[model samples]
Target: MATTVGVVVFPGTNCEMDAVTAVEGLGGSGRLLWHGDDDLSGVDAVVVPGGFAHGDYLRPGAIARFSPMMGAVARFAADGGPVVGICNGFQVLTEAGLLPGALQKNRGLKFLCQPATLRVETTASALTGRASVGDELSVPINHFEGNYTCDDETLARLRDEDRIVLRYVDNPNGSMDDIAAVCNEGRNVVGLMPHPERACDELLGSADGAILMASLLAAA
Candidate 1:
């Protein structure tokens, strides 16, 4: 059966379709699940896409964490379902306690929109299982609060457990340890600041993201 992937959407979410398009392009079915909905029964995988959820009020992903859909997502994740969060969605994952670390303001308080070179750090997560360690990918990033911050103990645990999935090649944002992505202890859930869905096609500047999305489909 074709993998059915659900793309979760919130009021201010702008990249749900981008995520859906990327998923369907990879031979997976795409379904949009509204933030108000709390059902996630049929989907094989879930993607929380980018954009300003609830206007990024009171901190990005803070408000969206309380959305009813997130409760369902939590349950889904607990059952070992694949879940990948991109950009703002990454923030939501952290706020929901699905992933570790928080995305704070970018260095110099500037909004960044450009191509980023990412190095695959591990393949244990749902997003990077198809990629090899040290492989570099070109993915675009669009965000103001993309800098990732975590406490010392969390960083130590991430390193010791091989949970850090990706790292920035040139360090575009001031993310700690040049981290670009991370997965939970179970490795079923993942969050990244770069928009792999936006990089699905070569015409969009890079097709490297296809491997990541394809990995998610295979995992699902």
Candidate 2:
């Protein structure tokens, strides 16, 4: 059966359609699940696409984490469902405690919008299950607060447990340990700074993102 991925749409989400288009292009159907609704409608997987949820008021994803749909996402995650978050959506996952760490302002206090080279650090998470470790992917990242931060203890645990899924090849944002993507302890939820949906097509600069998206669909 073709996989159906739920793309969560928040108040200020602008990349919902991008995610939908990417998933559809990958032979998976994308369903938009509103932030106000708690139902998931039996999606095979979920993607929290990038955007300024709640206008990024009081910090990115701070308010969006309280949305009813996030509660449903959390429940789905707890049941071992695959959940993937990109860019701003990554912040939402952290705020909702679905993933570890937090996204702070980018290094140099600037908004970064460019292609980033990322190395697959592990294949244990839903997002990287189909990618081989050390594989390099060219994916675009667009965000002002994409630097990932966490306490030392948490960082150590992430490293020791091999939960870091992706690492930047060039360390563009000064994220701890050059981290670009991470997965939860259960390995079902993943959060990443790069916009994989934007890189799925060769016309967008690179088609390397298809590998990651394919991984999500296969996991579903």
lDDT over C-alpha atoms for residue 130 of model 2 = 93
Ten-residue region with minimum lDDT total, candidate 1: 101-110
Stretches of candidate 2 exceeding 4 Å from the true structure: none
The TM-score obtained by model 1 is: 0.99
Winning model by lDDT: 1
- Candidate lDDT scores, in order, read 0.95, 0.94
State residue 129's C-alpha deviation in candidate 2, in Å.
Answer: 1.1
Off by over 4 Å in 1: none
What are the models' TM-scores? 0.99, 0.99
Which tens-of-lDDT digit does each residue in 1-220 have in candidate 2? 7899999999999999999999999999999999999998769999999999999999999999999999999999999999999998999999999998999888877899999999999999999889999999999999889999999999999999999999999988889999999999999999999999999999989999999999999999
Q: How many clashes in each structure? A: 0, 0
